[model samples]
Target chain A: MVNTILIMAGVLMALGILLALFRFILGPDVTDRAIAFDVMTVSSISVIALIAYFAGRVIYLDVALVYGLLSFLSVVVIGRYIERGL
Target chain B: MEIRETVGAAVTLLGSVFIFLGGLGIVRMPDLFNRIQAGTKASTLGTILSLLGLAIMNEAWIWKLLVIIFFVLITNPISSNVISRAAHFRGTRMTNKTVADLLSDKNKKISEE
Candidate 1:
């Protein structure tokens, strides 16, 4: 049962990544791409969490946490740069 | 034990579904702000749910999962708000159906004063 769930979640994450990639590539505006990138990061965090569960490793959770922080910082910096000539 | 594992798996699966929907919304939304709103809310909740599910599966890592959830909750909205504000300031065009823009009105008042 656990294996089945892991497989299903992996498939869904793959689909989500594909959709996010489409938006990131096709988005007309910079902000649109920024939003798409944000979505991708969030999905990646979930994927990492799933991997941690599947592998029974706790270290990946720390990686997810760090990745979340980095994503937030990147989005904020990009937003600021877009708003002003920074 | 079997029941607990099943429940956790189900929750994680549901979270994945929401994440997928968030990506779909980002692709399909007509405007930038709409996409940000959709992506932010859905992804935030999906992430938290997935983390919670993982915690359920691994009881020893519950504290770490909770920390990640809290971090996500705080950061997601802040990043979305910053992006939307920046986009608005940069004159990203809104859809024609947008009835009112309070930020623009406020800016006008400031300029007039």
Candidate 2:
């Protein structure tokens, strides 16, 4: 049951990533692209965890954990650059 | 066992709805502020619940999931706020549907006077 639910999340996250990609491309400004990138990070995290469940591996959970941290760092760096670079 | 499975099923369904709402917000919201608020809140709730369901269904993964949740709780809103502030600073200009410009309007008044 968890596996099935994870798969559903994976599918939704994939769709969300694609939409975010569209935003990244079509966004009118750097900040818009940055927000889209942030969303993409989140969607990717959900997908990664779901795949871990599908494969029945605990190792991927660690990788997902790392990705979550990295995504946060990336967002912070980007945000700081945007705020202070002016 | 029955109750555990039932609770898992309910949470899973509700979590999916929240995730879907988060995704819809990302794709559909007309402005950055709206998208950030909707996307962050909905997805955070959704992912936390989903992680809880995973922990419940597969007990061994609970520790790792908890760690991931901790990271998520700290990062999600911070990123949203940072990006929204950046967008406001960059003068991205909101759609007509928006009712508030809490930060920008204040900045504008100060700069004007």
Candidate 3:
């Protein structure tokens, strides 16, 4: 049952990624792409957590945390650059 | 133990569904602010729930998961605010249906004095 649920969750997240990717590709603007990227990163973090669960390793949670921090930094930098001349 | 796994799986599934809805909003919303509002709220909740679910399933890793959750709770809104402000300053136009812009109005009021 746990395995089935995880598989279903993966499929749903995959569909989410596909929609976000569509927006990224069809971008009428750069901000749209940035938003899409943000969504993708968040979803990928969840995926990484799932991977950790599957592998029975506690280490990948650290990977997920780092990934989240880096993505947050990148998004903030992008927003700052877009807001001003940086 | 069995009950714990079942409950955790249900929560995780719900979180995944929310994340998917957030993606749909990001793609479907007509304006930048609208997209930001929709995507940020849903995704933030989705991420928190996902991590919480994971932590529930794996009791030993709860602290690390909580840290990740706390970080996400702090950063998601800040990033979204920055993005929306960038869009505003860059003169990203709203859809025709937008009735008012309080930020611009406040700025105008301050500049007048």
Please name the candidate that would achieve the greatest TM-score relative to the true structure. Answer: 1
Error of 3 at A5 (Å): 0.8
lDDT of 1 at B57: 74
DockQ of 3: 0.84
Query: Candidate 1: lDDT of B41?
Result: 86
TM-score of each: 0.96, 0.86, 0.95
TM-score of 1: 0.96
| Per-residue C-alpha lDDT of model 1 across residues B13-108, encoded as one tens digit per residue | 888888888888888889998888777788788888877887787789999999999999999999999999999998899988888999899999
Best by DockQ: 1
Candidates 1 and 2 compared by lDDT, better number:
1
Rank by lDDT (best first): 1, 3, 2
Which consecutive 10 residues in model 3 chain A have the weakest lDDT in total?
A: A9-18
Clashing pairs in 3: none
The sequence of per-residue lDDT tens digits that candidate 3 reaches over residues B50-104 is 7888888989989989998898889888888888888898889898889999989
* Model 2 regions more than 4 Å off: A1-5, B1-10
Per-prediction fnat? 0.87, 0.41, 0.79
- The TM-score obtained for chain B by all candidates, in the order given, is 0.95, 0.84, 0.92
Q: What DockQ values do the models have? A: 0.87, 0.52, 0.84
